[model samples]
Target: MNISPTDFASLLCSRLCHDLLSPVGALNNGLELLADENDPAMRARCLELLADSAKASANKLKFFRLAFGAAGGFGDMVDTREARTAIGGLFGDGHRVELGWMVEEETLPKGAVKVLLNLALIAGDALVRGGRLDIGAETIDGHVEIVVRGEGPRIVLDDELRGALGGTAGDTITPRAAAAHLARALVTENGGSLQISPPDAPALMFGAVFNAA
Candidate 1:
């Protein structure tokens, strides 16, 4: 789990680029088709596709900004509403994954928010066949606790990612695990602990707790 800061940053950049490539590529392809199409109906379809792609790209960027970046210039604390919006946009598309946000705090420390978002991202992705993603967070006695649960017909939590979240990825860390590594690092830095549901369980759940005092 130990890596140079520069290398870790490169991994995060790779992950962001990989996730964005699909929608961004679709936008480029749609624009090209719109330029060449003669039929009005086909042109309209291309435009619709372009719009969807743009929205998807934007949503992913927003999620990553909070989960991995500087929170879009936000201060030491970030509004919970922004985190909710980002998660909704990332997983609420076409109801592929339903989101249930239960965080009551209006704002949380930046480190806590990042941990929450990254863990939610991991849980959401585990629902390979689409399902429910419930995220809950709260502060008790100056400590932040976050829990993300994903239940579906099929859940796929990559071993590397699980290891990363548990701070045991060792030399197998990759771009796909960048978020998990970062989450674990932040939690540990703040004297926090993480928990992952057993692999045989029907659902995937992640819980994190860190000192926010």
Candidate 2:
């Protein structure tokens, strides 16, 4: 699948907007309710809801900056701790999901970081029932290996996303699967490969191998 840089950027923007719509919309609605509510206690609850929505909006922007934009410093490597914080913030506010960080490297190449973040995003979404997400990455023998696992009572991965991750989406690509497509593109461009667990598998998992040097 070949896409122009402009088209790819548009797809990413669309995906970001789609993910942010709910929280942003909630923020708007909360403000309207707060303005109309006269009861002190109810107004307090509205304020709380507004705060929660604001936090969610901020978290999603932070996550997208690193995952889909040219964030971090000008250096070739990005701090893994930043990645951990971004992931935690995006999925930890409501405490619906658990995160397990297994990477020991202090910093990773920007390409690897983006791939890891995007994979984590996909895995986190697959855990529709709010499950545990484990993310790990390491560089060994000039190769960077990334893995993300999502476990829950029920896991669902859309076929389009699976195909996009495997680099077989062909002409059926959509904005929703843009992150998976980006992950595959980054790995393949770095002379590596991407893999995903079978759809029937008990757990959803993603694996990628790319040159680190």
Candidate 3:
């Protein structure tokens, strides 16, 4: 789809705001409650709620910094450890999803890292009922190959996301599908290919391959 850079950026910003609204709003509400509740136990509960919201907000920001912004300094390659931490922080709370990191490479090209993280984001979100998320990547034959898999009792990969990943979402792209669109665009720009498992399959899988930096 022909989208101006500014428009694409606006879409991403909208997505970020939507995802963060809940936790940030909770923080605001928690603060207000803490101020009103004079009871020690209630005030303590408020503090706990505030803490959880703060952590969630921080985790999302960290993940977005790498997945959607210029994180990992001004380098062409980023450490895989940082990526692992970001993903862990995003899903580690309450064990909503289990994460398996299988990337053997110490570092990867920035474009490859962004694509990998975004694919993981999509796959993780597909597990609406909580599930296992496995992310793996490696460089072979001068190409970096990345794969994200999600398995659970129920998986929901919406049509909009599928269309975005396939570059067939057409003219109207919702904020929710922005990550998929960004991943597809990056892979195409790198002369790479993206593959999504059949929607009816038992599990959901996303794979992408691009030249190594």
Candidate 3 weakest ten by summed lDDT: 70-79
Tens digit per residue, CA lDDT, model 2, 117-161: 999999998889898999999999999999999999888898899
TM-score per candidate: 0.97, 0.97, 0.98
Question: What overall lDDT goes with each candidate model?
Answer: 0.91, 0.92, 0.93
The top-ranked prediction according to lDDT is 3
Q: Which digits, one per residue and each the tens of the lDDT, describe model 1 over residues 1-213?
A: 579999999999999999999999999999999999999999999999999999999999999988999964755888999999999999997858988889999999999899999988888888888999999999999999999999998999878998898877777588999889999999999998999999999888898888985
Better of 1 and 3 by lDDT: 3
lDDT value, candidate 2, whole model: 0.92
Better candidate number, 1 or 3, judged by TM-score: 3
Question: lDDT rank, highest first?
Answer: 3, 2, 1
* Reference-based lDDT, residue 178, model 1: 89
RMSD of 2: 1.1
Model 2 misses residue 163 by how many Å? 0.6
10 residues in a row with least lDDT, candidate 2: 67-76
Candidate 3 shows a clash count of 0
Clashes found in each candidate (C-alpha, N, C closer than 3 A):
0, 0, 0
Model 1 bad stretches (over 4 Å): 72-75
Q: Please write out the lDDT profile of model 3 over residues 8-88, one tens digit for every residue.
A: 999999999999999999999999999899999999999999999999999999999999999866657999999999999
